[model samples]
Target: MRITQGFTFEAAHFLPHVPETHRCRRMHGHSYRVELTLEGPVDPVTGFVVDFFDLEAAFAPLLQRLDHHCLNEVEGLENPTAELIAIWIWDRVKPAMPMLAVVKVYETAMSFAEYSGG
Candidate 1:
């Protein structure tokens, strides 16, 4: 079985190398959604794959970095595409939660990317 939790943050970004007329070239923002999924045998003590609160804490630092800031200015994300952002988040939180199975980052209601692996 798997358990998943969702969180949202707003951040701005621009594709610096894109032509000026490109829609994504200008600075803009998205109501970003981050979904973390944990897969494994559930922990008997809590009867959960992972505690939601613990997951929240694990992602807190990453949330701070992405919340209300320009993604381009965030360290290590000079070109914060959705796929890169998902990987960046996975790198930060995976060490803390060894059972973490995947990270899904949504740039829009219909657009998203996922990353997983050790």
Candidate 2:
């Protein structure tokens, strides 16, 4: 079975690689939504792929670094685009949540990016 947990954080960033005329080159904030997905056979005893609470706890430290801050200043997130943020989150949380199958990041109501530990 596969399960996904959603979390949100607010952060500011700018894409320095973008053209000077591009608006994304200017710092902006987003109320970002992150979905962490895991896949595995259900544990016969616990009846869960993994405990939801444990997943939340495992994600807390990463969130602390992202929530209410300038993501561009965070290590490994100098660009902080949705695509990069998804991958960065995957890398940070995968060590603790080995079953992690996907990291989806929503940059806005209509836009999102997904990373699968690739």
Q: Which window of 10 residues has the lowest lDDT sum in candidate 1? A: 42-51
Q: Write the per-residue lDDT of candidate 1 for residues 55-95, one digit (tens) a residue.
A: 99999988999999999999989999998899898888889
Which tens-of-lDDT digit does each residue in 1-118 have in candidate 2? 9999999999999999999999999999999999999999999999999999999999999999999999999999999899999999898899999999999999998999999977
Number of backbone collisions per candidate, in order? 0, 0
Instruction: Tell me the spans in candidate 1 whose CA falls farther than 4 Å from its real position.
Output: none
TM-score of each: 0.94, 0.98
Q: After superposition, how far is residue 22 of candidate 2 from its true place, in Å?
A: 0.6
How much lDDT does each candidate structure score? 0.91, 0.95
Top of the candidates by lDDT: 2
Runs of candidate 2 with Cα error greater than 4 angstroms are none
Colliding residue pairs in candidate 1: none
Ten-residue region with minimum lDDT total, candidate 2: 85-94
Please state every model's RMSD to the true fold in angstroms.
1.3, 0.6
